[model samples]
Target: MTFLLGAASALQLPAYQALVPEIVPRKSITDAAALSSVGVNLARAVGPALAGLVIARLGVPFVFAANALSFALFLIVLLAWRGYQRPDTRVEPFIDATRAGIRYILHAGVVRRVLVQLACVMVPANALWALLPLIAAGPLRLSSSGYGLLLAAVGLGSVGGAFLMPAIRTRLGIGGTVAVASVIFGATSIALVLVPSLPVALAVLIVGGVAWIGVVTTLNGTVQSFLPAWVRSRGLAVYQLVLFGSTAVGSALAGAASSLFGVLPVMVAAGALTAVSAVLLAARPFPSLTGRDRAPMPSTDVPPVTEHDPALQGDVLVLVRWQVAAGHVRAFLTSMDALGHSRRRTGAREWTLHRDRDHPDTWAEVFRVGSWQEHIDQQTVRRTGDDAGIFSAVREHASDDPDIEYLITPDRTETPHV
Candidate 1:
């Protein structure tokens, strides 16, 4: 409940979403990117600890009530707000283009093993939420001091997990390493609950923490293996929601039920829940699509690319080239990830971020508007704002040269499949 209040306020704060209107009003793709960013920044600034402290120091009830009052303020302001007319960039393309990549990493198999293993491990290990603290205070007879120490061990282990993943994988083989780590975490949590002494419990928790790192690093590296450049952020966010949020809720519920009963009963219950989750995951559809399978694999043997199809054209077929600034290549393409939102405002058929893979620092954003005039207007407005950092802040920048090539060739491609 307390956590929800903080999350809501962080997202709802007027100071944050105000950035949205700026970009949306200008038919710029940069608004959603900037606005989501502002909200995130504000949360970071007011360190939630202070807010949580303030809530706790005050009456918890009042804290929640005041949060509600603040939300009312946000809604009142929003109700009065007017949005700009969305620009339309609809176009009949000479090429149908939504160029995304599906290149898999060399260690793709190992990384996949890690992703599945972590998801499986998370289903069980996370259930300690309702049970662990109770065990710490009740079974281990630890004061808050010992609990804090235990938390530190976990934090340290997570940091180590980030750095030690590759070495761990090489030593254990991906599947063996993750499986061993998962067992340790699960067994350690159970041991922590059963152990009678605070010192013993703490030792188990430190071991658990070390294993936890192995779990986290394996999962993180696995995700990086096949993420498309365009939807990278969204994909990560969705993974967090499904993998973290679902597991967290499942754990909390199990822990609460176990607390109401006995620790042994709760452990048994958690194990059963994990077994069920494992079955469900294994039964899900297509657990094995790699990047190479879904995308057009560019290879040396593929005769000098010659696709003239409009709707089926890949990204490379749209714009020939562009220049960008140094050090802004990643950021430039990242900003283009907001293309869908920008497309709505500007009525663009497509908003594209093109990057040179050979020199990752090179990139450009290509806008396809229905009418060439809207395209011209977008350029004129941004070119003027180029000096104000208005375009820089909201418009995509490039470490490579940032330029647009408006194709003048008449549409000649035959109609594709309906």
Candidate 2:
């Protein structure tokens, strides 16, 4: 039952998270992202104290029964939501889709940077949340209700932070917000280590909570902003994977370190590491998303396909031939390099660039996709409005419009029915 509940909780997270950007307008995404944290923080503030009271009065079994009923109510509410409709479009096979999602994240520079920062910040910052109960029991010598109160303090602080996030973000920008939040969180961690009394620790937690919400909401919004709708769900899945994975690992490591070296030393080390990481990451801050980044750039120029063409056709090859002046070869190649990333991130496989030996000014860019339909999806949905500059750069260096060709190998195994 425990395993079932855990799995259900994990599965529901990505689904709800993926729906946020789709439901909210693009202009208000940052605000929506911050407000989403508000809901979670509100729950944190209320749920624990309520749960403790219920457990005290009603017993563990009754609490579990109530939890099940709450889940059922949640399901009913989800079913009644009428805002979203899934499009009737062909999807790639599960394995292929997974591979493409991974490929996209690996190639996208901004996504990679965001993930790195998330991992660095989370690994150290999680110690406070994971070890607070231990601290209350060991150092502050608090009862269970006192520990619950400490948690409620953090939650209340988070709620306040969420309300304040928009103003903070407008003043500081995403990178600056994350940097400031990291430093604050690190400082709070150190303060928690030094503080002895229950009241002092609770005060530190409130500050820590604000910093926590600031960092997380900024990171979440940035990731959503960088991704187009086509890959948004998959990209967010990867983001959640990293966020949860790092926190879990960090908690375990912190626990072990505390056991060996004592709690204060481990926390001090973690806090210092988080602060240093913020400085290093801020040096090459994550890129902000422009309006173009959020809008899709569906191609209007893909050649018409007949019904005879199979959706599962293997390895559709694309060749783009460009004619550049001798002086422009370097510039053309540089632009093509950027274009290549766009292609790969969109689902292209086996991408390559080649120069003609006989005609020094002629260059050919080549790539393959798994199927004809996949290529069409790449043309229609995978490209983003941000790619216009990349396309224009390549065109600027070309003598004329580049020639494009699509090819596929014949499948010999199929025989038409007589």
Measured by TM-score, the strongest candidate is 2
Candidate 1 lDDT tens digits, 96-120:
2221101122113432344455566
TM-score of 1: 0.45
lDDT of each: 0.48, 0.83
lDDT of 1: 0.48
Report the C-alpha lDDT of model 2 over 89-192, residue by residue, as the tens digit: 35678999888899899889989998999999999988887788888888889898888888888887888898888899889888888899999999988888
lDDT of 1 at 338: 43
Return model 2's CA RMSD, one decimal.
2.5
Q: Which stretches in model 1 have alpha-carbon errors above 4 Å? A: 1-116, 161-163, 268-418
